[model samples]
Target: MTAPTPRAILEYGLSSGNVGLVQLLGLCPLLAVSNNAVNALGLGLATVLALTATNTAVAGIRRLTRRDVRIPAFILVIAAVVTSIELAMRAWLPALHAVLGLFIPLIVTNCALMGRAEAFASRHDPARAALDGFATGLGFLWVLLALGAVRELAGEGSLFAGAGHLLGLPGLELVAAGYPGFVPAVLPIGAFLALAGLVALRQGWRLRRAGAGA
Candidate 1:
């Protein structure tokens, strides 16, 4: 197998290795908070901040950390970063923070962050680790946004329905006033179906690319 180039490493989390659609990491928050675009964006940004900071911190102290204590050290780093983000949100974006609720604190439990710290940040320089975290976070963000948009549009006939809380802007209503939205699209089962659809689309694109190369 060929070793990953810098470009591949940088883009991995955002494309083929997306934590949401590809790796299915952090599904609890991904599904729970993604009922609308604004919530998804809020959570996504928080996750990004947590991941990038934790990865950088881990990489910076990697040499100092003993092998036996590395896992605990990484968890502490991740939790601290996440706690900072949660506090900032509580102070600045209280409405969005309330909407996200327990999920914000739950970011500490996201396996994807731990996976990156152990698999990439520990082995790479701080710059590369930060990039990986940002890229991975972006990958995760896009998936959340897409899933949220689809579910919101289908269920509520609108997009960014809660934007006033996050962005201070009213949401857009795509359908007529009388349009009866599909209720199931915003339910828990809808998240599963929508995510599956996204995964299938990604797989189809990959198949086409492979065939073209062949």
Candidate 2:
């Protein structure tokens, strides 16, 4: 198959081919940590970094690896990259890292990482692979942001609370004072409910577009 164009990359990886909506990768952390905007963006940024670095490294070393051992090689590369990301988070974003916990290291197992490696980066050049990685991560990030924001507003009556701790940007947390949040939204069931609503909304939009086209 031919490599996707830059615009196509963005459209698919960020919008049409959204990891949450379409590909449905990395749901473990998605449902667990998306209680607020801060956690979502923090993990999203980390995943973005992992994806970009993993893609670039995989593409850079593709020519040297044997075809038969490619899968293992990719795994090892991804592990190393994810570890590096984890350490950086621990050092600079300790609070966010603690909140995220095991999920940080679990990035190595995210199918999105491996999928991009074998499907795109292995065949494409580094620059294109990097672009694809960023786009893909952006897609995932957008979902995380939406989910986190919605849950925070509904569950805790606040927005972006504790957000700055991740990026060290003050004033990121916004509190909706005097609002009594829905408790269910902060629980595991709440993640499912919120995710279901999001998926439904996306499908509704697609259906509307189809009807318009028809």
- Per-residue lDDT for 10-35 in model 1, tens only? 67888878899888999998988778
Best candidate per TM-score, number? 2
Indicate the TM-score of model 1: 0.94
Per model, how many backbone clashes are there? 0, 1
Instruction: Name model 1 segments beyond 4 Å from true.
Output: 1-6, 171-176
In angstroms, the error of model 1 at 33 is: 1.5
Judged by whole-model lDDT over C-alpha atoms, candidate 2 comes out at: 0.90
Please write out the lDDT profile of model 2 over residues 29-83, one tens digit for every residue: 8888898888899889999999999999999999999999999999999999999
- Alpha-carbon TM-score of each model against the true structure: 0.94, 0.96
Candidate 1 residue 107 Cα shift, in angstroms, is 0.4
TM-score of 2: 0.96
